[model samples]
Target: MMNSRNFLDLEEVRMEVFSGKISRAYCYVLVKQGKIKAIRVGRKILIPVNEAARLLAEGVN
Candidate 1:
């Protein structure tokens, strides 16, 4: 399967990623916890493009 599709660094994700509203460290923790899907490219983390929406709609899976 193809990995790393075009993901929006959207405002909400940015807020969560940048502002400590959610905390980037926490996001990575979720990935490690298998709460959300993710992959690392070298030193960078990539969250799935649909992650925020999926989280909003379904939550924590």
Candidate 2:
């Protein structure tokens, strides 16, 4: 289980990481491709802040 404080939703990732340039579907693709790590809680997918930061630092391929 992830602490909410350390996680961001896909929407936040889309907006903050990709600056809303990427679609929500693309975020799912990253997860599926193992590019981003995520956990599914019920129907909600939670992405760790560190993962987002890593993506920012590493840039998306």
Candidate 3:
């Protein structure tokens, strides 16, 4: 079973949360700046769906 705290891969994250267009460089910056959340599982960066949603909402407000 998938864990509750699992995160989505960058491509999936971009396609879904970013409306199918987001820069790779910008994502790295966000990760470095900690504006968005990221978890390192092995060699990949993943962002949780809920966290991404919350961040997007926070931006609008």
Off by over 4 Å in 2: 1-4
For 2-55, candidate 3 gives per-residue lDDT tens digits of: 356567786666666677566877777777788878888898998887777776
lDDT of 1 by residue, 1-61 (tens): 1235555333345465344466666766777898876667776666666775576667665
**TM-score quality measure for candidate 2:** 0.86
Cα RMSD of all models vs. native, in order, equals 5.8, 3.6, 3.7
Q: Tell me how many clashing residue pairs each candidate has.
A: 0, 0, 0
Please report the candidate that would top TM-score against the real structure.
2
Candidate 1, residue 3: Cα displacement in angstroms equals 17
* Candidate 3 minimal-lDDT segment of 10 residues: 52-61
lDDT at position 53, candidate 1: 56
User: lDDT per model, in order?
Assistant: 0.60, 0.86, 0.70
Return the TM-score for each candidate structure: 0.58, 0.86, 0.70
What is the lDDT, from 0 to 100, of the residue 60 in candidate 2? 76
lDDT of 1 at 23: 66
